[model samples]
Every structure is written in structure tokens, then in C-alpha cells.
Target: MDYYKVNSKNLSLLKERVSVPTYDRTNVKAGILHIGIGGFHRAHEAFYTDELLNKNSNSNWGICGVALLSFDQRIYQTLKDQNGLYTLIVKELDGTLTKTIIGSIVDYLFAPENPIAVIERIANPEIKIITLTITEGGYNYNEATGEFEIENPSIQKDLKNPNDPKTVFGYLTQGLKLRKENNVSGCTIQSCDNIQGNGHVTKKMLLSYVKHAEPELVSWIESHVSFPNSMVDRITPATVSADMAALKETSGIEDAWPVVCEPFKQWVIEDDFIAGRPAWEKVGAQFVEDVVPYEKMKLSLLNAGHSVLGILGTLIGYSTIDEVVNDTVVSAFLEAYMEQEVIPTLGDLEGVDLNEYKKSLLQRFGNIYIKDQVDRICSESSAKIPKFMLPTVQSQLKDGGSIELAAFVIASWAIYSLGVDENGTKIPIKDAVKAVLHEKAVAAKSNPKAFLDIESIFGSLADSESFVEVFTKSYQNIMQFGVKKCLIDLNSKF
Candidate 1:
């Protein structure tokens, strides 16, 4: 099979199989500057922006993507090679593929190649919104202290020499400083990551960086800029070699960096853009006055559900989300956790039917076509649990809701972090605090308090006698009965 390479020239040829951009690519201008051009960004925000461009006469909302670190050089090169054009393969629940050529990305700048271009792009008066999908840990926030870590080596280096910046905070400081100097209007700095109150978090972290670097710019940023909180949801798995081959087989187009995601995607943003914005609502993006409830609901249900399944699934030798979700015991456990444990924490989410959402979440997670990897969900659980699951645990602790399921989830994570499953197979752990987690998990075998003692993740939960009691019992149960037996027992209780 001769597969045509994906580029601007081959869009016409590729359009025979996949939906190509209807908007004039030449006329598309970059109004939005996005950092971290990862799979989730492409599948969610960029997908919505593409729809907006297709429907609206306004073509100024085209995205200009940025790749910050040296490791991101491959994606930078791929996007640049394809002229910022790539294929998005949507895996529908009914075993259908919806392929589209996404051209919303008008430009891509690799920060490592030329940092000046990135700074200048941010300074461009036309660039209104500077969005980010730099993950939860990328914010340079110290979870334990609830403060930005100024002494991070990259931040320190960038602070010492702001001209050649390395960190996002440094780049943002220099760019916003230039914008101020250039008399460019302020724009919205939106975060598309899954953090609760992301906009407020971003504003605080950025201000913390700028205050230490350039105190003069602090007032300008506060008065000129607006940071809008957002709740973004999509199950976008990392693209593998098999996806490329699949694209070649189905669409007959060879894409260097194509993204694959489930059909369902959602973005709820606070309607607080300082500069002019696009009518993304036309393409199904909800603009709300307050995104907190939605964020709470999503993080507590979908995100935490992934963690729960991923930890237990990996422990039970299941490799993908669909595989684990297909198991009746695992599925029932998840349903109980969402209904009994998580839902109570999320007080009223306006215009949302919680039961329907929970049912849809199971369907999304169980989409066999999507093949969302368990390891991907299991990765960085140290960062994910605190943000996604533990909040529910905390809320449940305060309200006297059942924390049993959440406790089991935490215990599963601690056991999984030990780098070995029940069958003695080495479970490859990927976390920033892998060594610490392993050491603590090892220490926790005798003293369960050792694991809870990690003040950053567990916080004050270790002090709660009820939580500690349940958590210790859960940990011991998992060690004795294994994942499947324990899950069956837990589900039977529900």
C-alpha cells in the first residue's frame, strides 16, 4: 500500500479518506499561542479550534504551538515538517473511525532552537491568549507548602539570566515584559490541564516567578492580564507506532505525529477572556461563569476513576483500560466508587446529570477501539492522586462519607509503587518520586503510617484515625488477598 505523506500539498489527496480543513490555510493567522503541543491539547483544544475555524468566518484564531524542552524536539520537527498539519483519528464506541486532518495549528515554535522567536511571538500584539497544557507538575508549585518553588535549578538559572530563558515561567516573564514594553494589550492565560482552579494556580505561580525575577512587571501583569479557570476532559492516549500503521492502512496517509482519542471531548471555560476570543461555543465548548463545579466533578469522577482502574488493573495484569473495564468486578467497583464515594463530594454541578455522566464515563473508559493504555493512566500517580482522588477522600473524611474505596485506591497505588505485582512481575513505575515512593512503600509494610507520612500527597490525612484505620486495613487486605479477590470482596460490600 502506497501511503501519501501528510503535508499541505497532499491535503487534497488525503481529503478523499479523511476530513481536511475547509478553512483557507493561507489566510489563517495565529491569534492564540499554545505551549505544550501534546496529544491531549491536539485532541481537545485544537480539535475545538478547528471546528470553530470551519464554521465561523473569523480565521484569526489559528493556534501557534510551542515545544519548550529539548525532549520535545521530535514533535517540533514533525509538526514543522508537516507544516503544522496532522491527522486526528477518533475512535468511536461503535468500532468506527472518524479521521480528520487538523490544520488549526498555523505555526509551531521549538523554544530550544530559537528562544527569541518564542519571546517575540508572545510579544506579538495579535497574540491574545497564551494557553498551556504543561501537565500538573509543570507549574513549579510545591504541593506541600502551597507555594511556587523559586529555587528550582531551571527557574534559578532563568532568573539569573532572563535574556536566555529555559523554564515556562522564564519565557512567560520575558515575553510578558516585552509585551508590556511593546505596548501590546493584555491577553488571557488559560490552562487546559486537569488541575482544580487551574487559572488561579497559573496566575499565582507566574506571579511568584515574576515577583522574584522582575518586581516591576508584577503590577502590570495583575492589571493587564486575566487568567481563566477551565475544565478540559478527553481520553487521549499517547500515539504509538501501531497508530501510524493504522493510519496508513485506513486513510492511506502517513502522518509523522497523528493523535488518537475517544470521540467524547469537553472544555468548560470561565467566560473571562480579556482580549477578543473565538466563538468556540459554536463547536460545543461550554463557556461558564464558574468552572469550579465542573472541574470538581471531572477530577473526582473521570480522572480519579482512571487512577483507580489503572492501579488495580496493572496489579491484576491487565494492560489497557478497556481490558480492565470489561471485567465485571472492576466495573462494579468503579460504579460504586463514583456513586457512593465521589459523587457526594461534588455538590451541585449546574445543568449536569451526575448519573448519566457517570454511566458515560464507564462507556468512554470501556471503549475497546480507543485502547487507552493502563500504564499511561498509572504514570505520575504521585502527582495525579493528590489532585484527583485525595480531594474526594478529604471531602469524604470531613462529611463522613465512605472513604473505603478511595482508601483501597491509595493502597493499590502504594503497593504498585513498590515495583512488583502480586505474581512477582516487575511493575514498571514511572513517577518523579519513584525512589521515595518505593522506599516508603517498603517501610509501610510494617508501619502503614510511613506511607501516609508523605506530607505532600496525603497531607493531614495521616492524622485522621478513621482514614488511617481503613487505609491500613485496605493495604493489608491487598497484600493478602490480591487485586481480583479484594475487588470482588469490596464490590460485594457495596
Candidate 2:
């Protein structure tokens, strides 16, 4: 197979190999500016927009992708080189792969190279929606305090250079300022991360960041901007070299970076666009007045499911999520955890069937072809625990229900941070609070309460005696019997 790079020029030759963009490249205008072009953004947000373009829904709604961090430039350069075209290799549970060429992104800019270009892009009145998938950590938020880290050094620098700023919040305020000065309409800001009440948090943080950095812009921002809460779900594994290699070998299209996700994709967004939005619902997106029910369903069930087993997968030396979920004991443990703990906390959703959703998630997690890394899922459990896991504990405790699995997840997170797995192999841990977590993990070896006392990670759970008792017991069980045996023990007990 000849190595035909995916681009507008190679569209004809690679048409059968991968789905090509039907809309004329030149006619597509930039109407949406997406922050952080990562695997999830490409797989979920960009995929949906690509489908909308396929239906010829709106030409002005094309995406302008932006990269903020230094590492982001590497993968995004491929999109730029190929004229904003990339491949979506969707994986099925039974080893089927669907190759798609996504062209929703008409243009891309690395903000680190030139911030003004991105600023101008945001200031444009035609750009109505500014969506972000910068991840939970990228928000620069403290989950415990619900506060923006205003004291961050980068933010401090951005505070000094408000007009030519560095952070996302800086660009938001500065661009909105320019828009106001130019008498243009305000744009909607959509957050598509795993956080609960994502849009509400975005608005709160943006307002808080600017209140001190650019005080004058606060009221105008409050009146003009709209941050609609949204819930986006897709099991997009971080693209690896092998995925790219397979894509090229199979499709004869050499994509520098291609996203591989499970075939399941969903987006439930609040209908609160400030200016206007694309007809995404035409392509199966759900728009509701309140996205809380949907948000709870995803965060508690799907995300919490990943959270509960992610560290156990890492600790037991399972490389990918498929292998973890494939284990009969681990699968049974997850099934019991969801049924007895996580599901009891969720309210009845109007359109969604919770039981069916859980069944689908098990299949999604067990999709071997997708190769979702356990370390990737386990990575930042300190931050993730607050969003995906802690809420379940809070809700379960409120109802006076079982919290054994929730406690076990937290226990696994603490022990996993010790930088060594059960086999005594060194594990590289990544987190926003790794230093604090490491010290706590070490301290917890002698006293389990030491780890639970990390108020930022556990919040009020640290203050609960019953919660602490269960968590302490779970941690001790893992220490004595190892994660594998304890998992079996938990499955049988639950």
C-alpha cells in the first residue's frame, strides 16, 4: 500500500480507504474556536461537527482548532500539515475498525507561537461558540475549594500582560473586551470535560479569574457570555504509534496522528447558546434545558466505573482497560459496584435507560481493539476522585447506602500513588497533586488516616468516621492480600 498522507489532494486516492470531507474546503468558514485539540476533542466534538457538515447543515460552523500547551503543537502540526484533515479509527467490541477522515477543522493555530492570532479568532463576531476539552486539570481549578488558582505563575504572568495574555481565561476576557469595543455579539463558551455542571463551573471560574485580573470586564462578561453545561462521552484512548501504523497499513493513508475510540459517542448539552449554535441535534446530539440528569448519569456510572477499576488495573499490571474489564472477577466487581453503590444515587432520566447504559459501558470497556490504557485512566485519580468518585460517596452516604466500593476505589488511588505496583515494578504516576499525594501515600503506610486527611482529595469525607473506617479497612485489605485477591474478595462479598 502506498503511503498517501490524508489531505485535500489525496482525497480522491484515499476516498475508499477513509471517508473524505464532501464540502468544498474553501467554502467552510471558521465559526467555532475549539481550545485544546486532543484525542477526545477530535473523536467526539470534531466528529459531530464533521457529520453536521456532511449533512450540509451550516458552512459557517466550521472549527478553528487552537493549541495552548507546548506538547499540543506536535500532534496539531499534523492537522495543519494535512489542511486540518485527520482520521477517526473507531473501534468495535468484536474487532471492527471504521476509518473516517474528519475535516470540520478549517484552520488551526498554536497559541504559544502567536497569541494574537487566537485572540483575533475569538474576537470575530462570526465565531459564536468557543468549546473546550482542555481536560479536568486544564481548567486550573481546585476541586475541593471550587476556586480558580489565581495564584498560579502563568496566571500571574497573564495578569500582567492582560491584552497579550497566555491562559485561556485571559484570552476569553481580552477577546470579549475587544468584541465589546468593536460592538460585536458575545460568544457562547461550552465545556465538554468530565466535570459535573461543567458549563456552570466554566462561567464561575471565568468570572472569578477576571474579577481580579480584569475587574472592569466582569459585569459585561456576566451579562453577555453564556456557558452552557454539557456532558460528552466517548472512550477515546490516547493515540499511539501502533494505532497510526495500523491506520496507514490498512487505509494506505498515512495520518501523522489519528484518534481511536469505541464506536459509542454521545453529547448532552444545555440549550443556552449566547449567539447561535450548529444544528448538532440534526446529527444525534441531545439539547436539553437541564443537563444535570445526563451529567449525573455519565459522571456517576461511566466515569465512576472507569475510576473504580482504573487503579486496580494499573496495580494488577493490566496494561489496558479491555484486559481489566475482561477479567471475570473484575467485571463482576464492577457490576456489583454499579448496582449496589453507584446506580442507587442517580435520579430517573427522561430519555435514558440507566441499566441499558451500564450494559453498554461494560461492552465499551471490554473493547480490546481500542486499547484504552489503564495508566491513562488511572492517571490523575487525585483530581478525578473529586469529580467521578467522591460524588458517589457523598450521595451514597446521604442515602445511608453501601459505600464499600467507593471506599475501595479511593484506597486503590492512594496505594497506587506509591510509585510501585504489586509486582514491585516501578510505575510512573502523573497527577496535578503528585507531590502531596506521594507524601500522603507514604504516610498512609503506617497510618491509613494520613492519606484520608488530605482534605483537598477527600474533602468532607476526611471528617466522616464511618467513611474513614471503611476506607481504612479497604486499604489494609489491599496491603495484606494484594489487589487481585481483594478484588475476588470484594466480588464475592458484594
lDDT of 1 by residue, 342-395 (tens): 998887777899999999999999999888888899888878989999888888
Candidate 2 residue-wise lDDT, 1-494, digit = tens: 68898788888888877688888878999899999899899999999999999997779999999998878888678888988999999887678788899999999999889888888888998899999988888788777788898898888899899766778888888888788889888889999899999999999888888898778888888888899999999998898999988887777778888888888889999999989899999999999899998888899889989976688888898888889999988888899888999888887788778899899889888887878888888788777888987888898888899999888878888899898999998888888789999999999999998998887667767888999999999999999999889888888887
* Whole-model lDDT per candidate: 0.91, 0.87
lDDT of 2 at 157: 91
Candidate 1: which pairs clash? none
Candidate 2, position 353, lDDT: 84
Could you tell me which residue pairs clash in candidate 2? none
Query: In model 2, how large is the Cα lDDT of residue 449?
Result: 84
